[model samples]
Structures are given as structure tokens and as C-alpha cells.
Target chain A: MSAMTHEEVRELLAAHVMELLLPEERASVVAHLAGCAECAREVESLRATSAELALAAPDRSFDARRCNGVRSRLLARTAADRDARARLAAGQLPEREPLSLRPPHATAPESAGGWRTASMVLAASVAGLILFGGSILVQSRRELAQARESESQRQRLIAGLIGPGVRLIELAPTERRPGSARMFWNQTLGAWTFLAYDLAIPAEGRTYQIWLITPDDRRISAGIFTPSADGNAIATTTYALAADSLTAVAVTEEPAGGVDAPSGDIVLLGAAR
Target chain B: MIADVRSPDDADALVTRVAGGDEHALGVLYDRWSPLVFSVCVHILGDDDEAEEAVEETFWQAWRQAERYDVTRGAVATWLTTIARSRALDRLRASRRRQEETMSHLSETKRAAVDATTRRGDDPARSAEVAERRVLVRQALLALPLEQREVLELAYFRGLSQTEIAEHTGQPLGTVKTRVRLAMEKLRDRLGILRERDA
Candidate 1:
């Protein structure tokens, strides 16, 4: 085989380190390194160094407060979503509940209980406790499991979202505005997730509106948002992109009765490319 | 009776559960390693708030893609750390001016797990040799150029694929390959003699 140039060898160095060499390339590099003491030595040191860093990398958890905060926020939002869905189904007002509160369990009224015999009461209490405790345990385990699965999903998506030249724009906080929006827009994907961090939800008659700016700088109505319990405005459906036409995603105040145009001013912007 | 559980098996089980569209499992998985993963980010980024957000965002992503885990490759810590590192690095790369500077800071702040292993000097000569070699490895790593050290870490430590590495680095595919090769060659040359001498 002809002698490899320094550049050729250098190029091969990376592939070899990764063990990415095709069968022929792997063989050639292996063979060359065996006889080429200088090259062979370099590969060893590099591998050693990589191993060191990886091993040395501190594998500690982030701030407990931050993690707990996320869980609390998610839990609050999920509960609100459940309640809203329930209220929507019941045709009743969307009753908001705090973390310290829970929905009243369905059970017979107290009059039905007082007339019952002592045995019946004992049996009923036992059964009720069993049912309640079992349900809570199952639900909590289920919820915890859901959190784990969500974490995994987040990891993969974040991996995909991350690439060369990808830009992340964090929207400034919307001060005291209940119908506000926050954003994480990726110009590469031309996609954004409009989140309601802490918005005082609009009345049942009113809703939040999201607008997207076209590449030519014209504003396009994208979608509408409603804050879940905990006032989190989560986008139900992801917005589609139009090449680089996306400039920014803005949320405006609209009438309790919805409108075709400017219900309010721009609440948040991602400044999409 | 089953002994104490492990993170790896839980990770595997969590992946299976997630594949079935169970969100609770995702949370459990996040709780187990979010700290370790976040620490990796903070270590790489050297900022608490940024690291915290990165971890939160990472779990949000994990919820959607847990089914992709393949257990035969490596440990869960390795896989998650790889992801965390990638995210942290992406943030670092986005702030171009901070890249070169953050690295030196990393080097300064960095500490090797030199004596972490339980082996002792009184052990067999081979064990001693292995321990010594490991220490040398750590030393050799701190000596590499920032680029090579990083690519090397992501590949061997985190087990990222070449294409993924290329995508993460944002360099042209060919250029990435070339840079890895050059880096390996340099590292190989440095360690070749030590390895041979030890052998």
C-alpha cells in the first residue's frame, strides 16, 4: 500500500477513533497504526483522554427545588386539565382548585350512612378505605410512571431539536398578565411551543390568540389558546411552518366574545427566522 | 428476593412502559437520574440556572421518545449523560464567544476520578498496572485540544453515533470525520509509548 499522507491519516484518525471505518478502511488504519509507531501512540493517548473525561464527568442531579418545581407545575396543570375536562363534560363552571385541595369523591350522602347498621358502617368504611386507598395508590404510581415516561420523551425530543446552527429564543416573562404566553422557538425547525406560565385565565367568553408573522413580515393568525388550571396555556396542536416566513409568534388580548382581528397587543414573540 | 434495584433495569423497564404510552414511567425515570444528568450539564455549562433549565427541557423531551432505548449498548447513565452533554454543548455552541473561554474554565474546574477505584498498591502487579494506566488515561485527556477531547468524550463515554456527533457539532460531515481522525491520531501518538511500556 502507498504511504498515507498526513491529512489522509488525520482524516482516518477520527473514523478510527470512532471505530467508524468501513471494513477496508478499518483494516488499512489498523495495519498502518501497527507499523506507524507515532500514529499508533497518538491514538492511544486520545482514547485514554476521552475515557478520562467521560469518567470524570460529574453525574449529580440538578437543583432539587427546580426539579420539584417542574413536577409541581406539571401536576397542577394536569389536575386543572382533568377538572376542566370534567367541568366541560358536566356543563358546570370550571371550578379551580389549588394543590392543597382535591375533588370530592363520589359517595352516598350522610343520611344514607346514618340509617345503616354498625356492621354495615364498618363494612362500608373498610370498603371505602380500600377503594380510596387503592385508587390513590394506583393513580399516584401511574402519575409517577407518567412523569418518568415524559422525562424520557423530553430527552429524545431535545436531542432531535439540538443540532448545528439551531437557535433558541426564550420569551421574556409576561408581567402579571393572566393571558400571557412564553415561547421556545427554533428557527431551524421554524416551530415553537407557546406556553402559558402563569396567566390569569380569560373569562369563559374570552380566549387567547396566537399570531405568526410571515417571511415578508405580515402577521398571520396561527391559533388560539386557553389556560389550563394553574393558568398554563399549553398549545394543544403544534403549529405548521412555512419555510423561513415565520418571524414571531405573538399572543394578543381578545374580547370575551372572540374576534377576527387584533383582540390585544403582542404578548410574546420568539422572533423566528 | 430481589436485591436493591438498579438504574439500568429501571431505565429499560421505563423505556418499555413509555413505548406503551405510559407517562408515569417517564417521570420515574426523570426523577432517578435528572440530577446526574443535570450535573453533567452544569459541569459542561458551568451555570446553575442554565443547567437547571436544560435538565427540565431534557425530561420534557424524554417524555416523547423513550421507546428508542436499546439496552444492549451501555448503561442508562451513559446514555442520559450523552444527551445532557449534547444539549449543554449545543447551548454552549450557540453562544460562540463563550466556547473557547468556557473550556479553559472547565479544565480548571475539572477533577479526575483518579483514585476512585478500590484497587491498592499491594494488589497483584497487573491490577496495579491497570490502575496506573487508568490514571495516565485521565492525565492524557486533560492534555488534549478542546475539540478532540470533546468529540472523544461524546463518542466513547456517551456512545453517540458518528452521524449524531456530526449533527451535534454542526460541522460538515466530512469535516467532522477528518477532525475526529486528526484528534485520534494526536491522542494515539501521545499514549502509544506509555501503553507499550506498560505492556
Candidate 2:
């Protein structure tokens, strides 16, 4: 880019302070500010002006007195994030408790009736075990092996959620189901996790599938899922694509094995907030 | 962890610890700053739930970008409030777009209300209420010429670029830039005078 004139640079100073400048313009301003003491002082003055302007906004002194759960959520998320990053640095996947350890109601729909939901949950678990366990060496070790794999995948996702530079985008339910999904993604790593909560169980032959719609409108599968009896499913995967390339994520009802495209109802949808 | 963060330096130290993965430091930072952050978000987005989301995301963004923070630019509160404002504006854009898209599905009166809300850049009744609550910012902004105030609001609250503001207002790019510069300069002058007078 051509060097900006003093007059042109002056125009950009305030916008630069507000971070409204385009990337190239920002770089040019930063470059100019380095050598120009006069411009730097101007930047500082504008920054102070911005600061005062910001602090002058309405103050919720009374609201701050109440200890809402904001800090706890921040700490839980921060611990999760820091653990994920430490595990990555250590060259070991983060440790995660198996989803099976969670109570059935925590992972499945309570509205489905107690005993019926329990049976359905057990049946779903067995089917998943058989499908994934069939590849194992011994049939006797199927459950153990499946549990171990689930634990490992769970750890990987936990790490991804609190991973370095992660953005946790909460997907709202578009339908009547009382469930939601929160996605955590690190743009640099392209690692993402979709944490689906309290979703309704799919029919016997149907499953919940996630798809990411790219900015260019290409639908990429984020993989499929089945909530345990407690109605929770955690799916973690790497996209190897820039985070900005994604426009939104949606969960659709699909066949048991999943499909290449969305052909069912979108139960939940959210943009990159 | 130290429980009392009584100064900007303490806040700076907290940020350093947060960058090092100290969750306690983050909590302290949030305790110290969330109300201001919440207020900024609420003023811009005008929805409690959305404003709360902005607060959460702003702190998380602070954590993620902690290592990149430069103390020389401004104090931690300033830096954080900047992030909060940016995130709130992002929500405002999303909310406005959603309203526009879903207007046809709403009642005629609701559509008209939504249009008025959008055109005014915020809910006027809420703005008036908030302006009463925040005298300093309101006074500072009210002191500006309408042209300058409009450009400044578009740039700061709406997150519009100079070119976009120019296009939105049907003015030349040069005019928009000049108005913005003049506005900031005027604000700086007026705010400085107010500060010295208060002192």
C-alpha cells in the first residue's frame, strides 16, 4: 500500500482508535504512528477521549451489587479453556469423563417417560457400542473399548471448547424443543465442538446431524449425534478451514448413519455470534 | 490470589495473570469491570439478555486476546469497554437484520414499530431513559452538532466505517471523514474542559 499522507493519516486516527479501519488501513496507520511522535500523541489524546466517552455510558451500580452467575460461568469456561490449552501444550489429549458417566436424565429426554426412556437409552447405547465396537479385536472388550474411545473423544472436545483463541457461539433452538447447542471453535486450530443440550431423542431410524454452512453456501457435515437418555450429545471435529468461512451451523434430523446434505427439519440454528 | 484490585496497575496485573491462565484473576477482573461492560452492552443493544451475552463474550474475548493487550494504548477498563461496545454493536447489527427479515411475519403495527426503532438507531424511549441515567455521555453527545453527533454515533455505537457512514448519509466520503474528525476533536476539547472544571 502507498504511504498515507499526514492529512489522510489524521482522518484515520479516530477510526483506528475505534478499530473501525480495514486491516490494510490499520497497518498503514500503525506504521505511520511508529515514527511520528506528533501523530502518536494525537492517537493517545483520541484514545483518552474514547475512554472517557466509554466510561461516560450508563452505570448499573445497583445491578452490579447482585452476584449473578456471570463470574462462575466465566471461571468454568476459563478453566475448561486453560485445561484444553495445557493439554495441547503437553502433547496429550485432555482428560474427559465418559458421557456414559452422566445420569440418563441429564443426557436424555425426561418427557419420554421414565422406564420407556431408560429402555430406549439402553437400546441406543447398545446399538452405538455394537456399531463402534465391532471393529475391536474381542467382543468381550466391546463396552470397555467403546467407553475408552468415548472418554478420549470427550477429552478432545473439552479441550477444544476452552482451547486457545476459542469463540463459544451459543446456538438457539429454532423449534419447540427445550434444548440448545453451544459451539466452541479456535480459528487457528480449526478444532470445534458442538455441545448439544436437552435435545429430543430422534426416532429409531433417525439421528441428530450437524452441518456448517460456509460463507459461499456449501454445506459441510459437522457429523451426527444421538443424545443419551439425558438428552445431551457432544460432537467434536476439526474442519481445517478458516473460522470466518463458516456462516452458520444447524442441527437436522437425518438417517442413523448421517447424510451428505441436510434433508430434514432444522431443530436448532445459530450464526457465528 | 489477591482479592483487592484497587488501581489500574492492579487491573493490569490481573490481566497479566489471566493471560497466564489464572482463572481467579479473570474473576477479579470481571468483578471489577462487568457492570460497566454490561451497561455499555445494554445501552447499545437495549436488551438485557443480549447485553448479558455481550458481557460474557467480551470477557472471553479479553481472555483470548489478553496476551496481545498493550498497556500503552489505554487502561484495562478502556480496552475492555471498547471490546464490549464492539460486541454489542455486532449484536445490534444481527438484531436489526433479523427484525428486517422477520418483519413480514409480524403484525403491521409491530412492523411499523420495528421500522421506527431501526430508523432511529435505537429505541427513543429507552434512549431517553438511559440518557437520564447517564448524564455525562448524553451531555457530551448532545453538545455536538447534529451532523457531527450523527457521524460519531454511527462510528462508535453502530460500528460503521467512514465510507459506510458517507453512503448511509448520502454525503461525500471527505465530508464524513471531516465530520468524524471534528466530532472527536470537539469531544476531546469539551471532555477535557469538563474534567479540569470538575477537578
Candidate topping TM-score: 2
Cα lDDT tens digits for candidate 2, A89-164: 7755444422211111122322221111111112224323221211211123345445555444433444455424
lDDT of 2 by residue, B1-199 (tens): 0111113477789999888878778887887678768866776665676787788788888988899887766667667878898889888888877775233422332332222213222212122322332354456666787778777766776566788778767899989878888888888776563243224
Those runs of model 2 whose alpha carbons end farther than 4 Å from true positions after fitting are A21-31, A60-67, A94-273, B1-8, B93-139, B170-172, B193-199
Interface RMSD (Å), every candidate: 10.2, 7.2
lDDT of each: 0.48, 0.63
Question: Which candidate number maximizes lDDT?
Answer: 2
Worst 10 residues of 2 chain B by lDDT: B116-125
lDDT of 2: 0.63
Q: In candidate 2, residue A129 scores what lDDT? A: 24
Interface RMSD (one decimal) of model 2: 7.2
What TM-score applies to chain A of candidate 2? 0.48
